[model samples]
Target: MRSLVEAQISRIKRCIGERLLTQELASQEGEGVIIANLLNRWNAFGKPVCVKNA
Candidate 1:
């Protein structure tokens, strides 16, 4: 479980970034939320789907 979590964090660091670009505390929190939403959408769209032939 720990390694899985670490892998997710590493992915976030690699995909989005290692540092928060915002200066203010609230903005930094918002930045993290935005990154998480982005990752969720990215994963959602990247999944493979099955199709049925009529």
Candidate 2:
């Protein structure tokens, strides 16, 4: 569960960062969307989506 959360957080961070770099989204707005998506997925699943560590 921890791993899944971490992975999701990492991906969100990366996406927002890329968007920021491209000037496609303001940092705050990008982050807000990322959090919203993450929470939505978490709530929908009701369980951690585990990812295997590579």
Give the candidate number with the greatest lDDT: 1
Reference-based TM-score, model 1: 0.56
Model 1: per-residue Cα lDDT over 1-54, one tens digit each: 999789878987898889999999999999989988998987787646889999
Worst 10 residues of 2 by lDDT: 15-24
Evaluate all candidate structures by whole-model CA lDDT and list the values in order: 0.86, 0.67
My TM-score estimates for the predictions, one after another, are 0.56, 0.38
Candidate 1 local lDDT, residue 13 = 86
Query: RMSD of model 1, in Å?
Result: 5.3
Model 2 lDDT tens row, 6-53:
887787567555333334458768767766786687668765579999
**Index of the highest-TM-score prediction:** 1
What candidate 2 gets wrong by more than 4 Å, as runs, is 1-25, 47-54
Instruction: Please state the error at residue 24 of candidate 1 in Å.
Output: 0.9
Q: Given candidate 2, what's the lDDT at residue 16?
A: 50
Clashes of 2: 0
